[model samples]
Target: MKTHTLLTVQEATALINAGKVMALAGDEALLRQLPKGNWIAGTIPYFIADEGGVESRERLYASELTQVGAADVEIKTYTLDTIKNIAADGPDNGYTIVILPARSAIHTEYANHGRDYEGMFIKPIVGWIAGVHLDDLNRAAPKVVDGSAGAVLAAEAVAMHVTLSADKMAVIHILNLFRQDPDADVITFAETGFSASTCLVNGKPAVLAEYLAAKRIDLKLPLVADYNGAQINTSFQGVDPDGRTVHFYAPVFPGIEYRQAAPVGDYVAELGALADGAHGGVQFSCNCILNYLYGELQGRKTGDLYGPATFGEVAYQLLNQTLVYLDVRSVS
Candidate 1:
């Protein structure tokens, strides 16, 4: 009945040996000690567990897919070339769970172009970006393990394509606490990129970094774009040394309108309000590391919304500063 759980290496290994299919998250050292089985894991020491938000290297976070009505699953790894085929690789009537290592080439490529992959958004795709401990960011790299093949990959992505029973379907939800500030200027880019030198602010061409300086913008506030009714976020990484180019966690697309998000006061309370009634049929979930850090949620409770606090979230595409979850619903 638990959504995400904290377990010792022995506990997680035992679950796998028992033929339990799972998605695991933990420090690289801890995950490396587990035996191979029907499981896929990524490196991440942060989690929102039963007690609260906690970071640990001594245990693993496990999500048993079988416990949530996953009928059949196929685990596969993809490189940059094959990543685009992910949509075609999924179950026709089911959903997909993908994990990519942080700072890996495949991760960057997917973040920029994964949404355009043919057949995407057709089937529900949910997962998180594997990330290393903040302290080990410079020394150690993130990794994803394909338990089926006993492969530990760094430059690729591993995914679990799940097939639900005939009557069941997977539904995806995103909890975005921030909205477009109605008083803010509309911003647009001249080209699509993860980093930009120039942008149009309220229909006038302006230097990206200089423009931010003039407005005295809060770097913590992400650029929000409304895709139909869905708010997609592109988090600010930082400006270059010369303050000439601005970098973002997610790419900014040309032609799309964007605006700085409205300010948020208590992230925990606001996220809790958004999370109300969200736990009923959730099969899996993951939140952004920005939310974990910016919201100061290390010792706080976020209602029943719990999962790995990841570098990035996936809901058929890459997302930043957002919480994504998948629910299993029965259809007549």
Candidate 2:
């Protein structure tokens, strides 16, 4: 397993300059200094490392991909349409690092179909959405790099798909603390859609106003859907009063019913439990920004787990308030 680390600009520069395949997270200014190579990067200032949680603009959170017995690695860039063919043509056993600018049309598009691509993926993929500080989230757009050109402020996404050795295989998984609030009212929708701002409840297709009015629901607690035993989360962002629509941080997939998640308790302990089980094989990982704020993770350690705290996490699909990770193991 590869361990992630915090690096100084000079240190990171030396590594990238040496042809390392790195996934970077940090403030905008420092990420631009590295010489372009086999790497990808995103903007964010929060992380949970061996040193515990901390936010910084001067340093970078880096995950070295060239480790874990990768005999060869290839880095590539793509627009939304171009990326659709990755699995048909990419390495048979590997992982892709995806970094998309928040709120872009491509971001919205990918959020809806990330899983649809999974069927075509010859390799596993684990990635996240780039983000700015909470205060500048709406004002500052996130950035991504492909190394062929100068670091770019992405209008869409910049992905690095790596090809590992034949003896090694990439594996992807997610860890979620949220569970369905069984005690809460069962909410059902009539229509099928993705990224829906409004949906019918008990045959009434109004906004969340009525639902919010009747139930003592916590907006911070996301809607959870069980997919093949995996708890996928979608969070409530806000509502449009005029349109009677409710916005979501991630898409609510068509035809899948969802239930409000129960509030999480003792996140540090829960994180500890998750890390204890998964830390050994994790090569790349990212946690949701919501977990950091809602769990009060700053200045706390999640065992040996380390990675950026992103706006959204991707593990075959866009997810909210979850931790996603990738690992590679020898076939023999």
Candidate 3:
């Protein structure tokens, strides 16, 4: 593990200004110190702003940023739309830059607003979202927002810029991890009886219930249960030939009523056996939702809204356990 030192606002700002990407600890203090005009993404506070304020734009100080979330450490901001305006369309690709609603103007307004206003107002303000575009993937021209617009406009600019940067970093991390394990198979399971329709596996595509019915087994099996461990009996559904779609009784896990079919213990054990060689191993990644569900099952709750830190801890535990199996295999 790398030792992480918390950086002050000025130091963080300077690092960002120097064009260095920062891996933040995802704490409230770090979120507040995030420099304006730089992109950042991690769990931050999210909330709706209260009406009534001084109507002045102000740069958020470290102290003010801490108090911005619904709870502590969460930064509540707005979702802004990214608009690309093309001036001249051609292979040249040179474009003009325009900031809509003007982020500076919005920040100024928020500063003007007195203590009566609660929460960060992020909306209505539109601007160019900033992030490193891999190749020509990001060819859109910069957006233009008039500075004289409302606070929402400026908030939008801030949100878009920060989100784009954060998203870019996330993509890079994911890709790097994938590169480290190119042949790893992606498995998915969907829970039945959810209003959302279908569940996705590894974010590739959704599996509908109707498709699973084709492979259905005529048996009254335990479908799912809620967090209370109450089992709901449902018809045993068939799985796809690829072993991806599984229709089973829903588990009592809260929020999710249906249980998606997952690989049985035997399958996992077999894979572990294969990777048992002295130098071989396996890597696994999962959606944070799974960690949240497990935490709920374990009755562990970290008040942090984003819950990335909690997920990280869970991941470490799982990884260590996987290594233990590999160690056994090597010795055998």
Candidate 4:
């Protein structure tokens, strides 16, 4: 049986009818046409299909979850108030996959403070933010569907908890190609948010957007923060009309030192090389939309690391311009 790929609505329904627990991604209309079954999904028209990046309102990307969902699986929804219970409510020995509409209350809440949620980072958690067609940004709404309950949600999040056998374990992996340049000016913020006006550049107070302009910093590059050895990125969205405020796809936390990422060539190749040693281990994976556009991933490949190109990536917490994946392994 296939693990993941683009499937027609009829084909997906066949899998659903077979009692295959899964994760799905597609257009809102197509997703709404799916039959009730063991699955959870979010909306998105862009995907890194086996053939490469493509956008389609007719087909869906499906990842079979029978292995992880084999032992015991549960599908549920969470409102903004109940979203905090996500990590703590998962199976004791399994992992959780979640989806939330882009810019929804639950999405904003989880992206801003999900790291501090109870039981976070204790178990592997991975998912993507749902999004509408690029042209429908203002008119259309993003949604997540609870296939088992046949419920579609716009303001809420849907999560699937998959309990594996005692001998197996689930793990989350992040592939971030961007890293802080050693000599770049260090930038710090006074508050955490998706946008900032004032920030400290090399320890001197300065307007963030003005400083970036003065330094001729390429907005295509992201701000990188090092957590121990892990390099987390906060991608640039745009500068406000005032040119003093800078917006980011992900929030920048206060008290963290950040620097512009170093330049790199060939993101598609780099992404594949980064996951070279983990080929078959990746059971599910998703890339960021910024990468698809900025890196020009259309019609390119990332080896076995593929899925939808989402608005944002999530691995325990929100991430920008990165790839998030789930891998299951036997207990050593």
Predicted model with the maximum TM-score: 4
Candidate 1 segments whose C-alpha is farther than 4 A from its true place: 1-3, 67-71
lDDT of each: 0.88, 0.75, 0.24, 0.89
The CA lDDT at 84 in model 4 is 92
Estimated TM-score per prediction? 0.96, 0.91, 0.25, 0.97
Q: In model 3, how large is the Cα lDDT of residue 219?
A: 27
Q: How close is candidate 4 to the true structure, as a TM-score?
A: 0.97
- In candidate 2 the C-alpha lDDT for residue 288 amounts to 86
Query: Per-residue alpha-carbon lDDT of model 1 for 139-254, expressed as tens digits?
Result: 99999999888889899999998888788888899889889988999999988788999999999999989999999999899999999988899999899999898999888999
Model 2, clash count? 0
C-alpha-based local distance difference test score of model 3: 0.24
Residue 253 error for model 4, in Å?
0.8
Question: Against the true structure, candidate 2 has what lDDT?
Answer: 0.75
Badly placed stretches (over 4 Å) of model 2 are: 1-3, 68-71, 190-197, 202-206, 241-243
Off by over 4 Å in 3: 1-14, 23-25, 44-259, 263-289, 292-332
Tens digit per residue, CA lDDT, model 2, 1-332: 23389888998888877767678889888888878776778889998877788888888998987443324666666677766655554566677777888787677878776666644544666789998988887678888776646657667577766777678787887888889877755455654333354555545565565576567668888988877777788887766665456778887765776788987778788876786664445678898888888778898887666799998997766788888888878788
